[model samples]
Target: MPGRLKLYHNPQSRAVTAHWMLEEAGADYDLVPVEFREDGTRDPKILAVNPMGKVPTLVLEDGTVVTEVPAILAWVADAYPEKNLAPAPGSPERGSYYRWLFFVGSCFEPALIERMMRQDAEPLPKMMVGWSSYDDVIDTVEGALKGREFLVGDHCTAADVYMGAGLWWGGMFKGPRILESEIIQGYIARLAERPAFQRAMGG
Candidate 1:
């Protein structure tokens, strides 16, 4: 087993997703809070390990630094297999698991940012962008959740932690068509009911 992990987190940031994953995996870890400066600079301690100065930066016992949210969730799930947070290695379910995890960063995030942050700007050509458009992204997610209780297989996986967090955060900010979609709202409610999610939320 690996030694205790270190997670630099900030409640106001996406680090909350990693924190939730840690609780779900029941991993032995330390939460090192990184507070930002008024001028938007980060502490040297965080910059030393991850010059990107991003929260949710995880350092393993061997000092391997894992940045990015999906990578962290994937690592923790595989590290603690007994938790059943992931599917069997070669199963189709595992393939679906990886898909949704990657989808969040690849499709959902950029599309969301373009939609929310660039409302006054011209819509980027669908053929020119990776996510195509925010409407397409939302439609894809809604289609995925049509008859599914979770993103992959019957039980919740690390993908749920990432996806659910994104949706929940989006809805909180009133992301277009997110809160209005019954399917998305239902999925968020289910994930919010999880004990791990609740604990991460400081409930």
Candidate 2:
């Protein structure tokens, strides 16, 4: 049996990704909603659980706290193997799982943030920049998503939950560059159909 799990979340935030993961993993958990002040400060009660004051923080029965969206999603997958939301440890597919999961946080996120903020005017050397270029990151993801349903294997895993949420948000709010990409739009549409995704969105 799994430990008692509680998820601190804000519906408008990235916590939705973890919510989808929990639903996908079939994990019974409680959702603690956190509200942000107009000044952008989080509730102090939540800050006690996550100093960063971020949503998507997971607290186990032993009070082991887990932060970060990707990390939380990864843990849920492994914690509920019966859901088949990830490849087994030490398998080749697991390598793909780890690669894309980390890439979303390390590479894709920075790239998207840079593009959305229009901070690309100052070009840094490839070595100095972790994400390199926005276009490069987009191309890499497009290549991986092409002719495929999920990031790791034929089945949708936690990686898709993370990456799909980012893609869907980007296309919805980022700009025409993302919205114009048929592959991405189509992929997001497919992800939106999943019951887990719908439930997380409060549908």
Candidate 3:
């Protein structure tokens, strides 16, 4: 059986994504609010759980630590199969599920960060960079949600929570401005209307 779950979080940070996921999973978890140093460094207590010192670190019931937004979302979904937030193992949709999850983490996230920070690196070959370009990443995500209500299946799942949170934050921060399309806006609206998402936002 799974042990007690605890999340080290900072509401203003990416931990909001995990907070949403935990709600979607319907898993009981203790929230450990972390304070940031005046210099913008993370609290050492958070660093103890995640050397990377990132918010959204999840400590499993058995004392296993899970970091990174993608990993935490995936773990929560899988751990609570009764919630059906993720596709079952060995199912065909599982491929689409994992693909979008990793795409959000590996591709879209880096691209958004680079644009937000206004990186000055010389243009590298599209093959060299994982994201290729921010526009390319945004276009791909837009295309995925063009006519669909959810990324993977008919109903909302972990993919929606993960990707939706990214899009919502991207628009909220106005950094990369990736959520400019009507399709994406509509999708985000749907996500925002969810009870789980509302609860995560403390509404």
Candidate 4:
């Protein structure tokens, strides 16, 4: 087993998703809170590990640093196979798991940012952007959860943790159509009921 991990986090940021994943995996970890500064300078400790100075930066026992939410979630899930937070390697469900995991960072987040942050700006050409359009991204996610309890197999996995966290965060911020959709809201509610999720939220 790997030694205890260290996660640089800020509760108000996307690091919460990584925190949720750590809880789900039942991994032994320490939360190193990274407070934001008015002048926009990052903690030197964070910069010493990650030049980007992003939260959710995970330092492994071997001193390796893992940045990005999805990568951290994937690593923790794999590191604790006994937790069953991931599908069996090379299984068909694993493909779907990876699909949704990447979907959040690649599509959902970008689309959400555009819809929430770039409302007044001219809509970028769909062909020129990786996320295409906000509507399409939301539709795709809704379709994925239409009749399924989880993103991959029958039970919760790292995919659900990642996707669920994204949807929950989106709804919390009143992202367009996210809270309005019954399917999305139901999924968020279901995920919120998970003990790990609740703990991550400090409940």
Candidate 4 residue runs with Cα over 4 Å from true position: none
Residue 82 alpha-carbon offset, candidate 4, angstroms: 1.2
RMSD of each: 1.0, 1.5, 1.8, 1.0
Ranking by lDDT: 1, 4, 2, 3
In candidate 4, what are the lDDT values of residues 54-161, reduced to their tens digit? 898999999999999999999999999999999998998889899999999999999898889988998789999988999999999989998988888788998898
Error of 2 at 137 (Å): 0.5
Off by over 4 Å in 3: 119-124, 176-179
TM-score, one value per model: 0.97, 0.94, 0.93, 0.97
* Candidate 4 or 3, higher TM-score: 4
Model 2 segments more than 4 A misplaced = none
In candidate 4 the C-alpha lDDT for residue 82 amounts to 94
Candidate 2 local Cα displacement, residue 12, angstroms: 1.1
lDDT of each: 0.92, 0.86, 0.86, 0.90
Number of clashes found in candidate 3: 2
- Of models 2 and 4, which has the larger TM-score? 4
In candidate 2, position 30 carries an lDDT of: 96
lDDT of 1 by residue, 1-203 (tens): 86799999889889999999999988899999898789987898899899899988999999999999999999999999998999999999999999999999999989988888999999999999988989999999999999999999888899999999999988888899998999999999999898899988763
